[model samples]
Target: LRRKRSSVLRNPPPLTTATILSKTYYNVNSHQPESLDWFNVLVAQTIAQFRSDAQHDDAILRSLNNVLNGPQIPDFLDEIEITEISLGEDFPIFSNCRVIPVEEDGIGGGAGAAMGEGGRLQARMDVDLSDFITLAVETKLILNYPKPRVAILPVALSVSVVRFSGTLSISFIPSSPPTPSPTTLAFSFLDDYRLDLSIRSLVGSRSRLQDVPKIAQLVEQRLHSWFDERCVEPRFQQIVMPSLWPRKKNTRGGDDEDVGHDRR
Candidate 1:
């Protein structure tokens, strides 16, 4: 969150025209959503291949571990170690895939957010993943202020994503010169969603408390809150999509790699 805040501060909002809203055209809600059954099948195949690759390699796990350990630890936390990770055995099922009109800001109607004279199209899908995906980590919780390292507790937690059912809405934001950013894909989950988690926790140094009900409850609540703040309902996630146009820097298939001048 600190990193995100700093980045937001560094790169302020781009300048925009005062009459941009007046020039915009909004999507009408009169038309029904268009089905995308064929699209669903193609996406399913891609997910299957991804799961197959995950099973054969620890690359995903290594990357996940690096992400967890890469961030700077706060003064009140230390010695964070990833113990285990399990990528679920089954694939996510995406059904009821359909495209619908949305606001220019990429907010879909299903999210119950306010709309206006804005224009864009968004794809909505029902995603269901029923499998056990778990991550276990051990860290130390340090207590300071009154005195340095007054208390240090070894906290171990294992959280399993038991099941997830949600309505995922995806949309695209057109690239513009003023922003100095690429075309972006934005996605978010509606407020109405079900997420089941199995969490286990142990906290202490020598005499450990295993699966304490209060700790489990707190962790579960925190996880849900964290998720809601980022990518739920009105809040959405955006990914900058790089230009796909072939470029000499990445061109291949010649007598030698990066030899774009040579004909294949």
Candidate 2:
């Protein structure tokens, strides 16, 4: 039995990066507009859903808060501090995007026992950005007109979760929302550009929480390919000029004047 199980586990089907990449590329390229639209819609929907859901259900809100503010979450939380973002010459976009904490005061108790002996779980989240822009671009020969560039000169997000104890049972009280911070980003021409990105204190829903790590890994891979297809490769081909550029040096000011003076 052990040998049979071991043999089955040993072979355990191959997971080739090429196959995964090909599939991901195909999926991303095939849908084109619909896929891009879905990204926008999904982001909006996620925020809305969390907001609405937390309004009525205290349990969900507490969970969200705990995940955001607690130390148990991912390490990327620290990297999300973005202070400024600039495309070319435009000012920064989006000051900040944040996840507000939910208060749990009078929820049920049977599940409280499972919450372990402690104070209520506390949680919260927030984000800040500097600037934004929109550009027309394409992927796999499919054009995506007016792609939005949401920049954060300095971006930050945070969450905290804590457990509280009552007389009979332990309740979870999510942390209060973190204070909002100011940030800035710049917008320029409707052309190609690279963004300085950051993230902090990201926590997912209960249903998706366990899969967060795996999902994050997959997301990073897909994001790289997606950006490359839509931005990097196109720029490399010189298909479009980036809005931002380095300033030229003023060599004619100091040394050139001295040369002219000496000659005179």
Highest TM-score scorer: 1
TM-score for candidate 2: 0.18
* Model 1 weakest lDDT span, ten residues long: 108-117
Error of 1 at 14 (Å): 24
Best by lDDT: 1
Model 1, stretches more than 4 Å misplaced? 1-62, 103-117, 143-150, 177-182, 205-208, 244-259, 262-264
Off by over 4 Å in 2: 2-4, 10-13, 23-34, 49-264
The TM-score of candidate 1 is 0.65
| Shift of residue 19 alpha carbon in model 1, Å | 23
Put down candidate 1 lDDT per residue, 42-124, tens digits, no spaces: 87788778878888898987887777767665778786788988777776777776656555545633322222334555678
Q: What's the lDDT of the predicted structure labeled candidate 1?
A: 0.73
Instruction: Give per-residue CA lDDT, model 2, range 37-81, as digits (tens).
Output: 343456656665665665676575345445444676443333222
Q: Candidates' lDDT values, in order? A: 0.73, 0.31
Q: Estimate each model's TM-score.
A: 0.65, 0.18
Total clashing pairs in model 2: 62
